[model samples]
Target: MGQLSKIEWTEATWNPAVGCTKMSPACQNCYAEAMSHRLKAMGVNGYADGFKLTLLPERLADPMQRKRSTIYFVNPMNDLFHERIPASHIRQVFDVMKKAPQHAFQVLTKRADKGEGFVASYDASHHPYLAL
Candidate 1:
């Protein structure tokens, strides 16, 4: 767990999900894809599926555990909004983030086109902790 992240924008990083498909030329040298294979070789518990779309529900609460307010780069290793992932699972992730208001979550996705509607439709009132 990096309380201090090497990523320029965020203070910490989190990956509740991992693995992605090569969608464009930008994905040719994906660091996450390479790292996922290495992590799998190292026998990391969450990487058993190795570059396949795997959800690590156990890691969802990582940000909440940190008492200090911080910024988390959510799913830096994968696109959390991938179309292959269930909408319900994405909601589960949002639910976890909703409970941890002390931290800010940064989720970037190339597959936003597929999930943006769902995000727009989510009831923000019911989840005050989440920004959207």
Candidate 2:
């Protein structure tokens, strides 16, 4: 099942991977930082390392498994393009998104350069489901 989200702009949350690092002055009050720590303290499955950058390959299929259409805020607990997250893993997440066309993915990231670079190199044109 997809995780229902409280975030106003999106219908559900999908953290195929999670965790992020402080990148700038804008990160001074990141809600993810506090949430990760709190989730870790509560023994949340994917937050064993707390706010430290980590990957959860198992969650990659969350969206595909859900039959209903949804708007997914990808990696809401952290930036999807964090320096520590491998590009290959990001691709895996994208591959999942490409397969699940019923959903719209909102992939917001503080690391826009990396995000743009990934977009440039990723071969999405051939995929009928991927919009861009």
Candidate 3:
């Protein structure tokens, strides 16, 4: 899972997983949902469920090897804090971010409560790269 970016804020986008179900009004016209269905039809490997939650462990370490200082938009295709995702996997993602201190990781989540827990679990000094 090499870095490939389309947005201005980040140098690249990485999806450890794809496919996400709508959870709030903000998801009414989710880009991921549309993209997932299209990818599924094209026989892309990760979207078979078409917006159902899925995990991609193969992509977990993507940030560690990037040579440049980058801004990574974590899980732009889905919410990392979704209940369906395991805490252990979330921690792995965090661990990668911690290791890649040269990169800035922006994690946005509609699940605010879960986001709070994520922040509380980490040592602030070790994860200076994470931003809400």
> Which candidate achieves the best lDDT against the true structure?
2
Q: Which clashing pairs does model 1 show?
A: none
How many residue pairs of model 3 clash at the backbone? 0
For residues 1-132, write the lDDT of model 1, one tens digit per residue.
434688888999888888888787888998999999999999987789889988877787777788888998888889988878888878877887787777778888777676577778776665654443
Question: What shift in Å separates residue 72 of candidate 2 from its native position after superposition?
Answer: 0.3
The whole-model lDDT of each prediction reads: 0.80, 0.87, 0.82
Local distance difference test, candidate 3: 0.82
Q: Please give the distance, in angstroms, between residue 48's alpha carbon in candidate 2 and its true position after superposition.
A: 1.2
lDDT of 3 by residue, 1-132 (tens): 356787877778878977666788989989888888898889887778877899999998888888788888899888999988888888888888888888888888889899888778866778654555
Per-model TM values vs. the true structure: 0.86, 0.93, 0.90
Query: How are the candidates ranked when ordered by TM-score, highest leading?
Result: 2, 3, 1
Error of 1 at 66 (Å): 1.4
Q: Give the count of colliding residue pairs in each prediction.
A: 0, 0, 0
Judging by lDDT, tell me the better candidate of 1 and 2: 2
In candidate 1, which residue ranges exceed 4 Å CA deviation?
1-4, 126-132
Candidate 2 regions with alpha-carbon error over 4 angstroms: 126-132
- The candidate that wins on TM-score is 2
Assess the local accuracy of residue 84 in candidate 2 as a C-alpha lDDT between 0 and 100. Answer: 84
Sum up the clashes in candidate 2.
Answer: 0
